[model samples]
Target chain A: MTASVTSLVNQPYKYGFVTDIESDTIPAGLSEDVIRLISAKKNEPDFMLEFRLKAYRQWLKMDEPTWAEVGYAKIDYQKIVYYSAPKQQKKLNSLDEVDPTLLETFEKLGIPLSEQKRLSNVAVDAIFDSVSVATTFREQLFEVGVIFCSISEAMREYPELIQKYLGSVVPVGDNFFAALNAAVFTDGSFVYIPKGVACPMELSTYFRINNGDSGQFERTLIVAEEGSSVSYLEGCTAPMFDTNQLHAAVVELVALDHADIKYSTVQNWYAGDANGKGGIYNFVTKRGLCQGVNSKISWTQVETGSAITWKYPSCVLVGDNSVGEFYSVALTNNMQQADTGTKMVHVGKNTRSTIISKGISAGKSENSYRGLVKIGPKADGARNYSQCDSMLIGDTAGANTFPYIQVQNNTARVEHEASTSKIGEDQLFFFRQRGISAEDAISMMISGFCKDVFSQLPMEFAVEADRLLALKLEGSVG
Target chain B: MISENSPIILSVNNLTANVNGTQILKGMNLEIKAGEIHAIMGPNGSGKSTFSKVLAGHPAYDVTGGEVQFLGQNLLELEPEDRARSGVFLAFQYPLEIPGVSNLDFLRVAYNSRQKHQGLEELDAFDFDELVQQKLDIVKMDAAFLNRSVNEGFSGGEKKRNEILQMALLEPKLGILDETDSGLDIDALKIVADGVNQLSNPDNATLMITHYQRLLNYVVPDYVHVMANGRIIRSGTKDLALELEARGYDWVLDEAAAGVA
Candidate 1:
């Protein structure tokens, strides 16, 4: 059974097929001229250009940090194309005007871009390469005073909102990847929920990287105003390539007084081959801020792909009586490595935060959970609870947990719990003695291990996350 | 009790097994027939638990030489799960604690796997819930235990009862209880023995591996076999257990060695 598990994890990447289409790609390299050309290609306003230039200069001065517990070959920034997009009709009036090939690509990826064809109550913005090809349910969202569009389109139509909230939570020079994303991000979803109006549907964005050797740097910003609420979803996939591809994305979310924002992500980027030959290097920075009284921000993510993943989706509780939550499940198989978790910073009195992370390692992969919980001096009545659990499938796999707690307030309450477990021979024998197949036994055990985190996701996303985890861990135990 | 017409349920011959390259079972042999309860009593390090695990096809035990026949088929050829689906159940001496998997779900899966093996329609959740609730009574277990993780945080007696509950649910043709009475108090032992007694029928057989003769007092065995050094060295009627209990295992081992000489 262990041999079969090793073979199963070595199965070829399913989403490795490249779509043949004409792509207008910029020259390989990063410079002031490259950033300017990308900004000009998007036809952005002067302030947007200024923001990009500033971010570029900061990125040039920064160095990639090697603090994460992951190893990889050094990335040559000069050999990467900063921007690449499929050549299609410049302005698509409707799904009918979308190129047939592009629509077929989305269809093949199991994403329905057509409003009438979508079955779930989800509005999808399909971003291929560096541009948003189509967005569904725009009229329904626009009717309710909700602004959901591509960030570039938002810059053109709603510049004031973009200028007001963009980078307000996660600054442009926050980190190495965030700075890079800020400098050269092509396009991503922008969402603005108006005051006192709950978004009628779940908003989602599906990102796909098709052009080989092109780095995908997309920026997503969500702003929930007073008394407004919205739940957003993000999913990504990339085609196969012999050369490693770079993906650095930055996502910022803000919630105002009495508002709430729930963000969930199912990341299934192309993990390299079983031998760790080629795959996406996912370096993402996602953060949310509860900026007003009684506001809430929650993040739920299931990360199962990418050859090397270094991300930490965090929450900043700046509002009194606010709440912050982070639930995550990170699974790595074969040669994959993941160093992902969350940070909760409490700056408001009586603020509360909860963090639950589950990491499963199979084959020879390494999975780690690094988290931090900080209570400011003035936050006298703050509280935080955290639990991090790791499960190793085989003897070759590894799991690690690193939790940092800093409390400056004497009255604050903070608790952290961690455990490490292995899917040993006894557990499998017990299951097999009851007639469960090896694969089913592993899947059942993993699902049970991750039940806490999976429960935090929305209904549809929870189901998908369960299925995705099962698929990834198929034949991973004896 | 060993009637000439009784059918054989399990037959083991010259079974030699090793664990981590260390010989644990040296030419062990035993035979069990339908409707008969057999007790195998031995001292520590006698490979009693290893015998049960080998029968259950545990992967850690390497079978150097063995021939096991269950219901006239080569049991050694089947996978562990297939052995289970074919009505061979080994109530573990140490039941695993699998957290997050609810007892109800685990029982349902085990039950449905057997049902599917028999080419029977799998039971849905509602129907399985009803069936499992009825089976839970055999062990006198609370319905509330069904909601918790499988044997997680359960007391020693509760875990033993849970093993019986699974046996009651699966209704295996051959049930082997390995040291099920090891940690149970007298009252718990009586309850577990009663559960086993209620499940035993003319079509099924039970094999009890125990260190004490006290358990045999509650659920009397038809035959008693004394094992030593990984092999059964003596076999007799139920009276043999009482005699051995009074005299201790040393005299039996000495007698077996004298007989061999």
Candidate 2:
């Protein structure tokens, strides 16, 4: 019975196909000269070059932190390709000029970059390897003063915005991976909602890492001015390779007074084979700053891929009466390891934050939820509620929860609840006795366990995330 | 309710089973007709619950030696789910609490599985909702319970009612109530018993494993058997249950020993 269920869910990664595009890949080395070349290659402004140099110097001074529960071989930074993009015309006026092969690849991944076939309500910036290939619906967004484009393009077009909010939330010297990303990050989506104007449609970025030898360092930044609101989503996938790939990304969000920003991610990178031979090392730094009164930011992520995932999408609530929320569902199967959660820092009076995290572990994988909730000294009347739940599929799998709470103010209230459950034999028998097959039973229970987090996702993304989890859980029950 | 012409639904001969290498059911024998309700009254460790679980093909119990036939099919050869699909249902003594699975969805999926097994068209959500509402009336359950997770945070009585609700939805040929009356109060017992009575028909049989005569007072079994030392030593009508209730099983055990001597 377990074998049958395994056959149903143990499907090979469907988005693991490599695109046959050529040229414009930098040498496999990192140095001051390489950083200069990267900045020179993109025709970046002088300030951008100085920023990269500063971040590189800081990264050189810092050591890779070893506090995470996951273990991996020492990474050799000098051996990675700092830049790789599909060689194309200097500029693209329309989707027709884009490479057909690249367009077909995104289409196969269920993300159509072509304007005619793109999803109606979503404007996607499709990023390949080290650069944005195409960003759909730019004209429709331009009408509303919503600046939606690639970060590199934003640097050339809206240099003022880039210089102001580039590393405002997640500074370049914040962490080891963030520093590395700030130094060599090439392309990611940029969204700026002007004051009082809600984004017309959902903004999204679909990242595909096609090159095996190069590391993907994409930087994304979203800023919502006062009284404005925006919902952004990100999706990622990579081709199968015997060699592990490095993906270090930095995402920052800035919300002013009365602004609301909802950011969601469905990360499905290649998680290597069942033996845990090769996959992507996803180390990301994502943070949002609620900088003005009554501003709000929420992070929702469904992570079901990567060999090792270590990141915390956090919120630094700096405005009075600001609110923050984090909803996440992380699933690891077949030798995968994920130590992911969120952090909420309250520095404003009357601030409130919520954290709901669900972790599912199967096979010989290890899944952990590490979170922190901190209330500053002057943040009177702050409140926080956090719930962390873990579900294990088989006896070989493991789950852990680490919740840290610091309250410097007496008026602050914090509540935390956590639980761990396994898909026990008796539970399966109960379903089987009701004539439901093991495959259906496992999927139903999983979706039910993840309902709270999945409900926070966009309608279509929720469905897709559910299916992705089911597929990843296949063959894990034996 | 038993008629001489009624066909036998289940036949057990010299049935012996083991759980964790310890023999639980030793040389048990029983036979039930299609229209009859048989209640097995026994003390603790008398193998009453084990018999129900073994018949349902529970993984924990091993049928070491047994000749069990359900409608002339070898029941031991089937899997737990197959046995359920083939019209055997066991309303658990402690109904497992499955958090996050809505009761309505659970009932619909179970009902649809049986429907598909019979080669019938499965009911969609709309039709199933209407059907489930009608079945809810049999157990006097509120429609509100349907939206909640299966038996999650349900009171003892509510969990038992949910079991009967499932039994109503499945409509099995042989419904085994394994101590379903243990945790309920008088009111819940009456409602559950009424549900069992409503679902019982001339074409199906009920085998109840209970320790109390309270449940029998409402459902009124056609035959009551005294189970001791892993086998039934005496069988009689409803009067036997009242007699056992009045004077525990000590007399019956002495009588059975005397007969053996």
Q: Return the TM-score for candidate 2, rounded to 2 decimals.
A: 0.92
lDDT at A81, model 2: 97
DockQ of 1: 0.84
Query: Candidate 1, TM-score vs. the true structure?
Result: 0.96
**Best model per DockQ:** 1
Alpha-carbon lDDT of model 1: 0.91
**Error at A247, model 1, angstroms:** 1.0
* Candidate 2 colliding pairs: A6-A475, A9-A474
Q: For residues A286-368, what per-residue lDDT tens digits would candidate 1 score against the true structure?
A: 99999999999999999998999999999999999999999999999889999999999999999999999999988789999
Per model, the share of native interface contacts recovered reads 0.87, 0.67
For residues A305-332, what per-residue lDDT tens digits would candidate 2 score against the true structure? 9999999999999999999999999998
* Top-TM-score structure, candidate number: 1
Tell me how far the alpha carbon of residue B55 in candidate 2 is from the true structure, in angstroms, after superposition: 2.8
